[model samples]
Target: MRTWARTGSGLVLGACTAAVHLLLALPVAAALLVPALRPVAESVVCRLAGLERRRIVVLLGGTGGRAEPPPARALRYLATRIPVGLLGGAVLTLLGIGLTFAATLLFSWVTQTPWVMEREAAVVVSGLLVAYYAVPGAVLLYLALAGAGGVARWERTLLGRLLAPSREEQLTRRVEELSRTRDAIVAAVDDERRRIERDLHDGVQQRLVALGMLLGRARRHPDRAAELVAQAHDEAQRTLVELRDVSWRVYPAALDTGGLAAALESVAERAPLPVRIHCDLPVEPPATVRAAAWFVISEAVTNAAKHSGALRVDVEVAMVDGRLRATVRDDGRGGADPAAGGLAGLARRVAAADGAFTVDSPAGGPTVVTAELPCA
Candidate 1:
């Protein structure tokens, strides 16, 4: 009942508003013909058209963006809308005539006119009278509603054509976004390469060199070779571990074989601090999103364990509305900065996958890192 009342009120209000616009459009059209009055006429038509647009959108429930049209388009829209407004006025007139007939019929029956003779005949006449007004009334009501809806649709379509960005503008924006994403991906790849080279040269390469020296010594001294060989074996194992760590940093093998859940589990297990992981996924995300999620979680855990003097860390990963979301929080001495080396690289990696990365760390407590990767 309430909805019906509201809809009826909107239709009435829309009809009245349209009628007023029909009256104003004449002066605007006349002013447009005179060169001296063209500017003022254009401005007046634009303002009035804007008000009408808002009325249709807000009151009549039309779909359109809140954007203003150019002066020429506004004038053209106003000129075109006059016919629609006149039609609305005609609908209102029909409704008024039907209502008048109904009121007169009710008044005559209430007053007990002399010609109303038998109760049966009076009742039958009343039914006929009702049909006389009701049929046209119902038809006019439908026409009014259809007209209102048509006007609203037309207004929205015209507004979109006049105000929406051009195809060239849309393409330009898309190109710029792609360029920025490409640059971010390139920078992230270069940073990863440099870090890999540094790790190999400083850690694994040096260990291999020492292992060679140990083996060379063992070959020269037969008795001491036992202890030298043991040292060489230990060095070789350390080098292998370093190489594995580097490989994991590049891409976690668990992600490919075990999926996102097992990959995150590995990160939790490897983290120096105690980590509690909560992951709920109905189905696996795409491979690209999986890789980005793994990188973010691993990097966040490592940063928290190494930098933050935290007692515990919590990680949550979930798939929501076709997007993979992960959050890592630690109760540590906060003040984590995204501008720092590790976090900056993490941000770039997330961006490469068209994901959002956020860091929140105040001066004195828990630090939170969040990432959202689009899987759809």
Candidate 2:
């Protein structure tokens, strides 16, 4: 029922657009022939094409990313599409006529009006006459609907072939995108390096300096040597722990030795809040993909622990149609900004790996971060 309704709606919209195209056909051709009016014609045609592209996407589930064709190509498209639009309009008109006829036939039969056959006619004769009309009416209705569907497919194909970007244009766009991705990766790497430097200076290095001071004090004063020595030992242990943490932030050894699951498990265990992890993978992803997934999860978990005020986090990783999908959800205050510091870096990292990353964090609720990376 839903499919029928959607198809009916699309056909109606297509018929309306076809009428508009027919109305514009003469003026557009005349304008294109004049050099002064050529730009104006091109502008109008581009806008119309854009509207049709959007219509196709919304109604027919057509692929997007339509590029405006050149003026010459636009004129050719308009010329070619007029006839196709007429075909669509004709199909819709036939469908409407069929529906009207069926409605009239049923109405006249139900009310026993003389409009259908006759009020004095025999029942057997009336029944045979109605059956004779009904079978052909049904077949015509079916043909009309089928024609509507075929017209829709033809329009989508024509639009794709005429308005889609050329191969050279596509290559240029890809090159621009690759360049931007390269720059973003470089910036992210530099940011990571700076963060590591700050951590070493403020955390592990500070602890090492304190441990050195404690040991020096013990050596200088023998009367309190045992107490100072014990303090130095405790400080040394803290320094080692801080060093380990810094190293983990730089790059987890578990990623290389234990794979993505083990690495994520270690993260879950160390988080300040409870973290539930579910990982199901048919095969191990490439190393780059694994690293990208791990970082996305790790950064999300860290942000949740530090800023979200969340009680618990959930992490799920799986293989979906040859892509590795990793999702992290935290039950906390939302409002995570993807354009801001760490999240922005994560986006760039995912882009560098040719993956898609999304952050959904509405106000006063849970936050969800997801990354999809191609493993093939």
Candidate 3:
């Protein structure tokens, strides 16, 4: 039906154009006579002479811009400049018609017909041939314009189809980006852990060992060494506290002991900012989930205490449909863009344990980061 409608429309357009043509050409004598006045004839002759002169000059002078300006100075000059162009085109068209006649005359001669006896019949035949040639040209011109429009529409549709991402491809691309970001974060974390370990070993641990030796030497002295031994004892006690702190940071014992719940509670208690904890867990979660929860809580609490200008924070942990759900909400100014990098590390650490994470932070005083880890 659509094709039929288009075909009908094209037929109507073609018929209208043909009717207009027939109306214009109805008076053929007038069509061929109006542009043949004396001035028009003279203009046509001048243009032919100017064109021939330009061609000869260009050939002789090799286009060196060296020729005197070709006769360009009158109404005739104006004709040479402007009307000349139209006049020349008309003469060329007439010449082509003359050539067609000459060819017909030659054929007539070869067939032993009279030299030019049937002039009226020859003119009518030539007119009919020119008229028929225009029909297909008009059709082709219309189809060309239509085809160009269709091609533009098709190009637009193709571009739209190519640019839009498919769901599966979008997921695949997102997963790839996640993998790259995760690997970079994990590498950075391992580097930081190693640095911290090295610092403790070279600095604090060495100082602690020296302090212990000093305490042993003070004990060996028998004369008036009690005060020295007491001072050494104080130093040794301080060193032990530092060592334990560094040890806890390497891996907290509570994470392996009571479970993620108790570990998170310890983190909350340790937070410099006021912290509220709500926990409703079941059977302590899986080992990896437990570890993830512990780390997330630790890092969140540390970040809140250190940077977030918040007075209070809330930590919530619960099992919702076998998934370990935990959230940390801070009452702080909170316009966070994850692309700025810190949260990327948090994201990967959770993802490594096969968890889902979300962050919701408004402009002021209420930021929530929620995580869900597979209990399995």
Candidate 4:
């Protein structure tokens, strides 16, 4: 029943589409002959072509491509569709006639009308005749539907070829992408600088001021001077540690000295969660790619440890097919979103280096974040 219904629907839609294209094609063809109306008619045809493309995509389940900028490709697509639409219309007409004949035969038998046959026949004989007409009519209907689908598929292929991006368009898209990514990179750099400045001012500067006051008090009270000196020394050491941490966060020196593997190992050691690092890379990637890889792993681990109530985290870095692939997995509560805040920033950072970043965090248990950077 469903199949029959779909067939009926397709036939109707095919007929309608065919009639519309036929009407539009005549005006477009005539307009081409008249120089004054050619451009206006072509523009109208392009709009109609867009409508046609949408119909093919939605009703026929086809990915009809779009022409870049100019309407020449669109014009060609419109011209080609005319014949295809006419073919569909013819099939629908034939199928409709067959179905009508079968319905009329059934109605005649039901009413005992002598329109179909002059005399009334036996029950078996009537059933046999009805089956004969109905079977062929059903086949015709199915064929009509199948033809519509085939034509739709063919049209999609044709449109794809006609509308495929030109070299100029491809280059233009690349330039735009680069421009957007560059702007994002600059913004991220500025944000990082501001954060570092705030951390230094609020944390290390206050500690240093308190340390200086302690040292000055120690000079005035010589008896308790030893205790004050020790306290002042501890404060100085803590300030140094904080400064080093800030510097590392900005750009780890370990990346230059020990390569990406060693740098990732240091990250694992610092993470709040018991992070296990497994890195296997024969050589170092480009500086930019290495930095992006480090950021991806570090951020992923930090996010997991902070948000996920996880016992352990795992980090894996490998070089595969001339690309650096890093994955950070945690056994904790998931549901990590990649669209906003920290994750979104990380995505932009990776994209700036022409790398790919992905996060797979469901709900209950495990979260996985993967990044791939071209080592070449």
TM-score of each: 0.63, 0.82, 0.47, 0.61
Report the Cα lDDT for candidate 2. Answer: 0.84
lDDT of 4 by residue, 153-187 (tens): 66667667666666788899899999988987887
Angstrom error of the Cα, residue 292, model 2: value is 1.5
**Every model's Cα RMSD, please?**
7.0, 3.7, 25.5, 8.8
- Model 2, 27-120: lDDT tens digits are 9889989999988989998877777777777777667446566766666666677777778778888788788867766766677655433446
* Local accuracy by lDDT, each model: 0.78, 0.84, 0.59, 0.78
Score residue 311 of candidate 3 by CA lDDT: 90
Residue 41's lDDT in candidate 4: 77
- Evaluated at residue 306, the lDDT of candidate 4 is 85
lDDT for position 300 in model 4:
85
| Local accuracy of candidate 3 as per-residue lDDT tens digits, 1-376 | 5653443333333334334333433343253356655445444434543433343233222121112222222112222223222333333344445556556655555564644636665432344444565576556546544543343333233223332344676799789977876785686478547757886987688877777777777778767478767777787777777777666655678888877767777777677878888888757777777877877777777776766788989899999988998898888888765544556667767776667878887787577888888886
The weakest ten consecutive residues by lDDT in model 3 span: 60-69
Cα misplacement distance, residue 180 of candidate 4 (Å): 0.8
Q: Which candidate's TM-score is highest?
A: 2
Residue 65 in model 4: lDDT? 73
What local lDDT score does residue 56 receive in model 1, on the 0 to 100 scale? 59
TM-score, ranked from best to worst: 2, 1, 4, 3
Order the candidates by lDDT, highest first.
2, 1, 4, 3
Regions of candidate 3 where Cα sits further than 4 Å from its true position? 1-185, 188-192, 198-203, 206-224, 336-342
